[model samples]
Target: MNNIELLKSSMINIVENKYSFKNNGLFQTDIPNLDFYFSSEPTEFNAIIYEPSLCIILQGSKAVGFGEELYSYDYSKYLLSSTHVPAKVKILEASEEVPYASLRIKFELEDIYDVIKNIDTNKLAMNVKSEKGLFFDDLTEKLYEPVSRLIKLIDKTKEEMDYLAPLIIKEILFILINDKSGYFLNKFAMEGTVSNKIVHAITEIKENFNEKLNVKELARLIDMSESSLYQNFKTITSMSPIQFQKKIRLEEAKLMLLNQNVEASEVAFAVGYESPSQFSREYSRMFGMSPKAHAIYLREEVS
Candidate 1:
């Protein structure tokens, strides 16, 4: 087998052995901020907070939608969420015999900055396009070694994990930033950069999606002018501020409706919509059904 095939086999073995076979879903590992997933079925787009992390799909394929663009990755590529953003994830492929096995390492923004600080910034290629909050890059052998090494630490002693796991995490981030994606990662990591400011905007909207958004106030908080914030924010998130807020609110409402037993009007009010009619209208438009019907559809999907 080639290097990627070998890595996949190793990863599948580790996850399958580590997890109990009672069910198939996200299985948190002993490592902090590191987790694994084993799934045997495809799913509709599920909204989530995509943290700044590195994700590798060892077996099946996956795709995440940031705004309108859906970025897909598999064994040959790694998905990077440079900023914390609201996203929708869909498992594109999985089966009983060939389940979707993947791992995600959620790292802090400061950790990325610390890695870049040690490496001489002058050496990094600076011309790469600063893409959206989430992106895909080719997975190389260099990158795979550290990731595999990190997973190997899962069954080790806590003291060993405390001392070595972090070093491996930093090493993985270092390899990522030194590659073509470095420019985009570096741009978002630093303060005062346009992308960084836009990230701040995204965080604010996410935090207070229920509140009425004041675009000018958001720009001021991030030290940006309104037009500049709008342009750069759309360039990164692929939607305007109001549109982004609406999507997040709706996603949050869907999350609540699916998890909580509540009326659609209650969810609308909780998610900041003033009128139940308007909420029902928008929810139907976005989800292709009324809130109650959509909930039934999702429930039927699970059963």
Candidate 2:
């Protein structure tokens, strides 16, 4: 069969199996580190923070903004995020006729290291320097097979699943390590590398997102010069330190607005925005509506 036909078939089977489980915003497989989503409608402007994961869209398209760069991925392309960076994501297209279906496999640095130790290092290409948190790469049939097998394993009994998922997981990583962007993944997994240091800064920002930060202090914390820190931070996150902080702040404010009846001013302060007007301005720009209006619209949709 042709590649398109193969992908369609695999997607159909996967969605059928996904529906067998309890329906939610996201679904995790019986195996650890495997999850999929069947989003019936497009998502709104929101930032999701997650660790290194591979995301493949079987149908429809998504637009993800990391720092300043926006990336769109469809069936022909896949997204690989090597670090946990805050970013906005909106599902640009989806419907009952063509629902948005995606599979995300989370990879642990330890797991990648273990696989690297066993494999021949000479097979990997030279490391490539990249600044964007999101990467879009062409998908191949060989990459599809391992993912398809993992989805198929969802139907197996617990005993069969326990035995087979790890092998499949390792195979998936092997395919990724040999792909065009494999070096980025490889560098991320290595200790004491520039990529590793940047990963550390990302972790600090995520853990202390609510706190006011100083660039020099953060640079010292990560043991890098101010210039080196600024360059590396912008490279990996696609935004400067202040910009990353604002993204996190805005995302937090959005959650508060949706989940609570708190005043906009209170939400702004809570998210580290000292000026409510500044928060409102940034919120309107990001969501294309004012904070109060956006909240009301969201509430009306739910009601």
Predicted candidate 2 versus true structure: per-residue lDDT over 85-170, tens digit per residue: 66778988887666777778898877777777777767677554645666679888888888888888888899989999888988
TM per candidate: 0.87, 0.82
The CA lDDT at 236 in model 2 is 83
Q: How much is the lDDT of residue 27 in candidate 1?
A: 75
RMSD of each: 2.7, 3.5
Writing each residue's lDDT as its tens digit, candidate 1 over 1-303 gives 888678767867766777843357777888897898778888788767677899898878988887767778788898888876667789999888887888899998799899988888887666433457877888898899889888888888999889998999998888899898788788888777788888888889989999999999998999988998888788787788998899888888888888889999999999999998999999898888999999887777555
Highest TM-score: give the candidate number: 1
Q: In terms of TM-score, how similar is model 1 to the real structure?
A: 0.87
lDDT of 1: 0.83
Off by over 4 Å in 1: 20-22, 44-49, 63-71, 86-89, 127-130, 157-163, 296-303
RMSD after Cα superposition, model 1? 2.7
C-alpha local distance difference test of each model: 0.83, 0.79
